[model samples]
Target: MRNIKIVIEYDGTKYKGWQRLGDSDNTVQHKIETVLSKMAGENIEITASGRTDAGVHATNQVANFRIDAEMPTHKMRSYCYEYLPDDIVVKTVEEVDLNFHARYNAKVKKYVYNICNNKAHNVFNRKYEYHIPQPLNVEKMRKAAGYLIGEHDFQSFTTLKTKKKSTVRNIYTINIVNEDGNVEISIQGNGFMKNMVRLIVGTLVEVGLGERPADGINDILDKKERKYSGHIAPAKGLFLEEVNY
Candidate 1:
């Protein structure tokens, strides 16, 4: 068997999420698997580096699957492009080592959240960005984000109630870029719990809106409770930017 790795990009507007749902067929994973399974003439299962919630876009989502077919990687990629929806595209495909597991070998993941900071919403990117009409204190938001960088238990940021084996994650960097009427929050981390990045963005939004203080992030981390964090930001604004191995 040959392990094939593919880099994918998807709009995620019409799909439920990356993972397949039992009751729903509108999922990115199911869509790709169906086409690949048909090509391989067998049931095919692909493992993604991580899952993106519904309405979240992805620019460089990575996944790998083993196929018995000896078709050229480029041919497989062309087949995917021919069969997949217009919104989802297989960007690159290559034969990989059998030991390369996308999820287990991921070293870093980068996510970006886009915000429209003007009173007027961006009609072109409305479905891809979050609209915040109120003026945000960008400097304050940056200050709050500074406290979140480094290794720490992020239980307070995730909505999951069940205990994870380890909530501790190392955030390598958090960048907040403010342009004219637009803001982008980019975060790079080793790993993330469910809703962790969105929750961090929500807390920073509160700081930017003056609802929460910049220094309050420290207290929230110490508490390790979800209620102490701000609201979960909308999923539409988030994008899976890259996965580094």
Candidate 2:
């Protein structure tokens, strides 16, 4: 058997998420697995780098599966793309050593949240960005984001529904960039809890709107109370940018 690594990009507007569920009718992983299973003429299980929440998109999501067939890695993309749906595209595929596991080998993950700060939401971009009409103080948001850029117990930033045993994670970078009427926040980290990025963005939005002081972010972290933090931003704004191994 050979381990096959596939890079995928998808518009997560229609699917249920990355992971395959028994009851769910649609999922990115299910679609890819179905296509690969048919192509290989056997049951094939695919594993992703991580699970993205519903409505969250991805530009470079990685996954790996083992296949008994001997096919050229360069031709794998063409074969999968021909069978996969339009919403999810297999960007590239490579045959790697059997020991290279997608999820276990991931070292860093980068996520980007897009905000449309305009009076009127663009119909074209509505599916991809979170539209916030109120003007945001980008400088204040930047200041608030700095507080989250280190190892911390991010209990305040995660959803109460998260079942993860550990909430502590290391955030290597939090970058906010404003161009025209769009604000993009890019976060790089070792791992993240459920809703962590959305909650962090929501808290920063509150700070940008002057509802929460920039320095208040530190207090929230110290409090470790989810109720004290801002609301979870919409999942559509979040994108899995890249996965580093």
Candidate 3:
């Protein structure tokens, strides 16, 4: 058997998320696995670098799986592309060592939340960007984001239904960039709790709208109370940008 790693990009507008759910009808994983199993002529399981929530897109999601076929690694991309849907594409494929588990070996994951701050939405970007009509205070948003960088217990920023035992995670960077009526919040971390990025973005939006003081972010972190934070932003705005190993 040979282990293969693949870089994937997908539009999550219609799917149920990345994982293969028993009861759910469609998923990114299930779509890819269906094509892969047909090509390999056997049952195959694909593991992702991370599990993105429903409606969350990905630009460089990675996954790995093993197969008994001796096909050349370079040809694997062509084979999968022929069978996969238009919204999902295999960017690259490479043979890797057996021990290269995509999830456990991931060193860092980078995500970006995009907001279209203009009065009118662009029809071209409707599916990818979130439209927020209110004007935002960029400086205040930056200040709030500054407090989120570094290691902290992010229970307050995550959903209450999170199943992870430990809520402690290290955030290497949180950058808020505003350019020409577009606001992008990029966050890089070792790992993230469920809905953590969306919640963080929501809190910063409150700060940008002057509803929450810039310093309130620090207080919220200290309190570790979910109720003190802002609402979770829509998943359509979030994108898994890349995974570093």
What do the candidate models score in CA lDDT, each in turn? 0.94, 0.91, 0.90
How many residue pairs collide in each prediction?
0, 0, 0
Best by lDDT: 1
Listed per candidate, the RMSD to the true structure in angstroms reads 0.9, 1.4, 1.3
lDDT of 3: 0.90
RMSD in angstroms between candidate 2 and the native structure over all alpha carbons: 1.4
Give the poorly placed runs of model 2, Cα more than 4 Å off.
20-22, 160-164
Between prediction 1 and prediction 3, the one with superior lDDT is 1
Query: C-alpha displacement of 235 in model 1, angstroms?
Result: 0.8
Error of 2 at 103 (Å): 0.9
lDDT of 1 by residue, 55-174 (tens): 889999999999999899999999999999999999999999999999999999999999999999999989989899999999999999999999998989998678747889999999
lDDT by residue (1-245, candidate 3, tens digit) is 99999999999999989974477759999999988888888898999988999999999999999999988977779988888989999999999999999999999999999999888987888888878889999899998888888999887988856555888899999888889989999999999877899999988988998999998877898887788889899889999999999
- Model 3 Cα shift for residue 156 (angstroms): 0.7
Candidate 2 per-residue lDDT, tens place, 93-171, comes to 9888999999999999999999999989989989999999999999999999998999998999888565558888999
Ranked candidates, highest TM-score first = 1, 3, 2
User: How far does residue 51 in candidate 2 sit from its true spot (Å)?
Assistant: 0.4
